[model samples]
Target: MKQSQSHDGSNAQIGAPIPSWKVLIADSQPDQHDAVGRCLASLRHDGRGVECLSAFSAREATALFGQHPDIAVVLMDVGLDGPAAVQRLIEHMDKATATWAGPGLRPRVVLCTRDPDQWPERAAFEATAIDGYVVTAPMATDRLYGAVLSGIRLHASMIAQDSSQKGMARVMVSTAGIFELRSSHHFYFNLLLQINSLFNIVQDSLLFVVGDSAPKDDVARIRAASGRFSALRNQTIAAIEDPRIVSAVREVFQNGRTVQTNEHFAFAIKTRYEVMAVAFIDGALGLSAMERQMIEIFRTKATTAFSNMMLIDELNASQKAAVFALARVAEYKKNLIQGHHKRIERLVSETAREMLQRSFHPEELDEDLVAKVGVASVLADIGMMVVPDQVMHSTRVLDGDSVELIRQHTIVGWEILRDAATMLRGRSILAIAAEVALSHHERMDGSGYPYRLVGDAIPISGRIVSVVDVFDALISDREHREAWTVDAALSWVTEESGRLFDPLVVKAFRTVVARIREAEPDWLATEIASPALAGKITTAKRDLRRMIDRITHLLN
Candidate 1:
């Protein structure tokens, strides 16, 4: 006969403890109080059961954590009345697991928020460190149980990975306390000095950006340490992107978002020539499991760093856009070409999206970046504005002086964009645009100007525009040149692929050109040169197509 365990008048089977599993419940509501206990009482794995712990408030939750280091899973309410805490005690516990705890600790967390979408908690949940989330609603017990089981399995995998990297020597400490490790601090500083021996490790490079105010002192320590460890900090800063990776690191610290990598982000970083690492630093440092109390502390520091990194991408994009805009204005004025810039923008955008879709094995062309590529294309000819009208329109070959002034536009574009760095605070895509605007004239063989940056040194945007810009220019009737037929221009670009263009970009251009032709047979010859004006027509066509597709799919 089977035994039955009683909870809230419901009976659940109870057997021996589940191997490699322990569960904790951190909630205040009586229903959750009853339902969770009943659910836990029923849990079984391979016919074995679970070791369960329960807590009602944030404080009790902490006590439960103290006693049960092997707690594999936690069901935590997002809010707990612990001195008006900005973050739930569950978050605090989760942070502790990831950043400070050793093996036999580091519980996987499941957040149960009443109104998970409100204010800081919502942002915290999105950015915070938790294995999974379940909104408190009817039938939420099922969701809670599933999330817990999944988190436990994943956490076990992470434990395995950390176990593999057990031999690496590193220090795990609080944000401020990190500097206290004299040898590591000294080593970090020495690395910085070797990279740049200027201004004795500038503190400006080491500034921290915090997205939340609750960890005010945490932010202060990271900031305050700059003055004391100026050398170490400056070196760290020099090695980091501006706005600082520290800001993102801090947000992650306070919130503790599960750190996962996507191919798009991975590719973007590589395309931009950056090296990024996500690590379980605490586990690597040989910290004791009881020392898991420092999880929150590590998270705060990591969040600041991560935030700063994201901010850098944003800033870089903004600066690029401003520069491109300025260049476009100059180019438009130079030839009095009203819509030439606009046409280029459309061509570039269409080509890039198509190219990204085709060449990237994982087509992760973000919709946002696709729009940005169009904007960059529109501004690519802006540098041509710095050239005099006579030279711009002249069919005659240019003199040395005229060529020299024209070559200065890339630098000019960069200069005009430097002041509007704030505009770039959140968009990294624009920076790629700026690179395209400034370097579109560059040849694959290092024959381009402003910076004779060859091969991969030239931004992908620059490479992309190289094919699009040239094709547009060849097929458009500019002041000094007769327009070539679409077929002629296409053949020219396709033939020049590796010699004058990125081969992948050239191939993408062909596909886009084909798409445009299929979409509109006479599109190339229609002569809608002004992109802003043509946009309305294009939008209408897109809308109609979407409607037709929806109707067709529904019928199918």
Candidate 2:
């Protein structure tokens, strides 16, 4: 077998002109290879000429493929050694190409034969992955040129498609990861940028969303934008100067369907609750059929992601409402002052924010944890609901038995929240609430509560709520005692730093108190709930019934 080389009878040189396309010609007859090479020596496609690689046997052809991995087309003789040798060469090429170029990126193969009756076109294609068959009895140069060019074009098209598919997969994974991090704006903006990158377009794009509670006359506002449209984010559609884009967006919103026009493409994404939003791709009029199909796939995936985010938001809201209703019921049963839990919630939230600002417990602190610990703090005394009314409301000093019974509320509250958390498949807020209920009363010195946990052994959530809960109780008037002065309560908390509270928590608590004193000195005197807190109270009655029904279902 002869060694493979460029048609010039020498190895390719460093300064040799690079051809736009490479074609391999494999046959046992050296004259056949030379004749085919001579016929196509001056031919060019897309203004660039082709380079031919000569291989004298099946083994030489396989070796040529290894040397030139970028070869776009292969011209093989069906009877090189036998049908078996040709088949073996094809299989080897397939495995080798697929390893580097991927399964969808194999080179195009065109078979040549002297006897057409032995290898018909239909049988040639079915038996092997050949792109074309040429009858070489007369060696028609025109037929040979046409077949080789067609194979090169087909290979180029395959490479384009494979690249598009890979780009789409990467975009999907990146968008999903951003969504998981809970930044909806970042996720949407990243999707738009990726769409442009995938299609090789530099056009402006805009994503508009209309809330479910929006009025009929309300216009969709831009949530995310790219290119020139980026400056107009959070603006209504009317803000865009392009009449063509405005019309397309309106048409999509009105019809609740995708709109394709001569100048733009607008897609209305629908979630379970409503027609979620519209994605406007400006200057997308000339997208090919494949590009359009890829956009549709992206739209479908975006819809699923939108629906999932909405579901999670709804679930979190429902959990918070249930917790508030349950806390209110316990407070009412114990005849505690109104707005007491609300104050505790605010105090806990403030302290948590301060802790995060100070970088305390950096690994465990985040915005989500701050929000959850505050809401869960309201459930710290949920065990009070199980205490007897007489023992809870007694004006007289409590006896030893009464004191022990009162302490049991901590254990009882933990059990209730722990069971509810289990029933909810371990919802994070409930798990934190269970920890607060169980350990909030325990002192840092191992002296307090049912479990007597010491220092950091107690969960951070419990430690945070313990300090804030005590501060609120001391400053608020109770049935058995008058309210202490703010200064006295603050001094007591500062003095009990490590003995009765987590030192880190107490540190944050001091900062929180100082801020409150500076910003809202009369905050403690105002028993009236803020508008937002008042709304929560107004819904408590309605949510109480729902909470009971849910708990009943969980119990069953």
Most TM-score-accurate candidate: 2
Q: What is the lDDT of candidate 2?
A: 0.77
Query: lDDT tens string, model 2, 382-447?
Result: 998777888987879999999999999889999999988986753478888998999889899999
Q: Tell me the tens digit of each residue's lDDT in model 1 across 354-385.
A: 86666542343555566566765565555565
Candidate no. 1 TM-score:
0.38
What's each prediction's TM-score?
A: 0.38, 0.63
Q: For every model in order, what is the number of clashing pairs?
A: 42, 0
Instruction: Specify the poorest-scoring 10-residue window by lDDT in model 2.
Output: 7-16
